[model samples]
Target: MRTRLFALAAVAATALSGMSACTDSDDGDGGAASGGGTRAGAGAGKVGVILPDTTTSQRWGTDDPKLLQAAFDAADVPVDIQNAQGDKAQFQRIADSMIAGGVKVLMIVNLDSATGKVVLDKAKAEGVRTIDYDRLTLNGGADYYVSFDNEQVGVLQGQGLVRCMGGGATAGAEPPMIADLNGSPTDNNASQFKEGYDSVLQPRYDSGEYLKGPDQSVEDWDNKEAGVVFREMWEQTNKNIDGVLAANDGLGNAAISILKKDGMNGKIPVTGQDATVQGLQNILAGDQCMTVYKPIKKEADAAADLAIRLYRGERPTTGDRVKDPESGAYVPAVLLDPLPIAKKDINLVIKDGFVEKKAVCAGRFAPLCRDAGIK
Candidate 1:
């Protein structure tokens, strides 16, 4: 599972200076609100944020709101952050509540483009500034966008698979059979991720260096559904699948579980994103190859920076812009780079405080963590 991808560790330079994971208390009304009492002036209304869901990734439930709250609290700007819990109706209701409550700025990690566009359009009609956080709303036409180089995240997965498969097809051996366990089709980031990994893998498939196996997308990035999907692919492939390009940690773990059931876990290389504790443990145990780490603190900071500026009624300028592939409109953006993590690079993530060392090295993983110099 070793590779030269350790060079990508430089992206950690923008990591959080100091912060540990903590439990965020609820605001009693089914959301988390931070900052002081309402301030008097033109742009003093609280900033409203709507997160996508908590089940798909831990970041939505634990990391994002806390980081965003800290950012707003530091600037003394009131904010209301809420998770939609993966419901489109709840997403709309949350947006309606924020807008009707006179929020000056609304930021969101949209559940989907159609749902987001409705909310963004409503906010725009009400003179509230909007920002697309992490996942861009396709035709939503958000004023600004903040996220990492998501396509690059997929590129890393493809490259990681190649490295774990012992490089390209050998002269006397058959080309490795690769399976793609993609993210939800409805997510724009999912499409971008597939585009990225395909850029790296399609070439090999064409050159006879690799054989493409079952390619499928998990519905809503559900872990249980992902397990079912991977199991089906395993049966369809007659367990001949050699490697997996799983879009994120959840999907990757799903495939790894299926492989483990057949005692083929370590034999088949698997790639993941999000660098969750489970994913890191899998890397430690040799069940998975690598995961992409997109520093959430950096993303939350960048989005909050933009929201703070908007809340102050100050025009924000960003050097980067991302065009909405569906609308052909360019959005002001603050894009960060994503880092690829292998077993050897797990220490970098721990050192960055994204995942606590204790959480990653718990119980059975303690020895493996030490062997990898994670102390």
Candidate 2:
């Protein structure tokens, strides 16, 4: 497993280096140059990207890197991308290496928020600008944070589950029982998602319109752990679970798998985030209810642009300010909105080219794909 992971990293590094060298002659601003005008910041310093993990979702391997690389290439900035594969020690080592290699800007999707805070502190001390990508690194001094409106993401999850419970007006009488499986405890986004979801669900729960079972926070957002946790919840609840509020697609899928084993497939509604291929398939298959669609291209582009601006000693524009939990300092942040996707809007995700139809429709899902008009 270690060898395969390292090999994948090597391939990614080589690919990035090749692309960087090819685009080195252009200016780093990502703007087209006039006929005889010199490119802006031509041969600018390197930009290092430290991604969290690939095991959790397919987006890390496909959408994230592709979009980020395109944005960086257009900006003409060289990039060095690495995946930590959910290893905190490996994440630290990767950050250290990037800093030592004289990277001017560093972007990271931290696997562990506490450890990430330490890494960000080191980057700040070394004068390297840091952009917290997707997941915020709490208590860490981050120059900029780029992500979706996380609270809204949770609200969507809550609302979707409520909808899945059937008529909102009669939800009180039915009072579907649900299990809440949140993401990694260390990630600040997890809390933000919980806030949004709870804000919606708590009202229903308090009004006796819905019954919530055991709510568990999965460590590292591990699907296997989520499966085990959910299985235990199933047994504890005597298999009376009617709905599930899973933090993301990976965990939702894990929960769904366990539900299927218990012969509860398509009977309960499950919520998810990050409109991953599997999540979308599950939606079409009637196993999962909905997923929050956060366009990776928009996010990756924004982060790259902000990182470049910071590298040039410019403050990027951001609409929101988030206080650092540890430092008590407010930082500029760009918070985008999230879209909830169901089987009906699967075409929208496809129209946006977030996922290829073939990728989602392959294997057993092919027939379902055609039925859903995925072509």
Candidate 3:
């Protein structure tokens, strides 16, 4: 993984050579959080990256920054990556510091639009170009947006759930009652996830192929809150849920924990996204049906490439454009397709080098991974 990433960076450095002065407006005034802080790099120009929260998803603090930084480093572009840890105010402050430091490109995963708008507005005033990374900042006037085809992520989840539940269940059995544990309403990606999964599930529900059970939105994608809600919903439904449509890996794991207590872990199908280590492990253990794998390296590489172009004052070509749900303005976008990861396809991520063999094979999971032909 390290070797391949460095090779990518080396190539990028060649391409970006002597391109620093292409953009005159490199300095920006922007405003954020008690951040994970910044990682300063010495290069021709700097790209400032702000990840939303380490608490919500490990991708923000772990996977994304590593890949994003590697991409920037390969191209010899200096980068500063930081996290807000879910604090909107801290996110603003981090942006301010980046802007004051004369960052050429500002890429962010917004905590919320209200706070994001202020930061974007500030960056714009300082002549800094902005890229909405992972999450869109509706009407924030970001120059470009990059992320997975989030709705397709949901479609994959819904499809995976249908496979797990439909394949295992006895034909002609009573319509299965399913529950939804969605992500926070505040996130644009969360809404896209809901829409994606809902698009697949709602039709089944309407046709009586599946029955809708308890459905709830998890504020901030909080697992503890999801656990509480799932527990109560389970009790209220008399433990009637036959399938679970969890929005992401965290919520899926939360539901899995509760279901395990009731001895229903592998018996009910649960769907998730982010394809975190836990999510992959759960798929191996049969507790989770599948997870949406966005291939962080590709995502990070794309964002970094886009950031480099944006910093060089180049119009990055986009295959498509998407309307920000909030502002209804079509923004240039680079939306990558999401892949569905079930146990059989776990090898895909492994082969793609998304997860190191040792990371998933460590400890007691070694035997399970070996049993799954992962070793």
Q: What ranking emerges by lDDT with the best candidate at the front?
A: 1, 2, 3
lDDT score of model 2?
0.78
Give the Cα-based TM-score of candidate 3 against the true structure.
0.87
List TM-scores for all candidates, in order: 0.89, 0.86, 0.87
Candidate 2 wrong stretches, greater than 4 Å: 1-44, 168-174
**Best lDDT goes to which candidate?**
1
* Candidate with maximal TM-score: 1
Error of 3 at 348 (Å): 1.4
Off by over 4 Å in 1: 1-41
lDDT of 2 at 94: 96
What tens-digit string does per-residue lDDT give for candidate 2 at 1-375?
Answer: 000111111122221222211142434422111221222232446889999888888888778888888888887778898999888999999999987777777899999778798787777666676788988787776777777778889999999988987843363365678799999888888998999999998888887778878899999889999999999999999898888999999999999999889788888999999999999999999999999998777778677876666555444345455666667766666666689999988999988889989889989999998898876
RMSD of 3: 7.0
Worst 10 residues of 3 by lDDT: 1-10
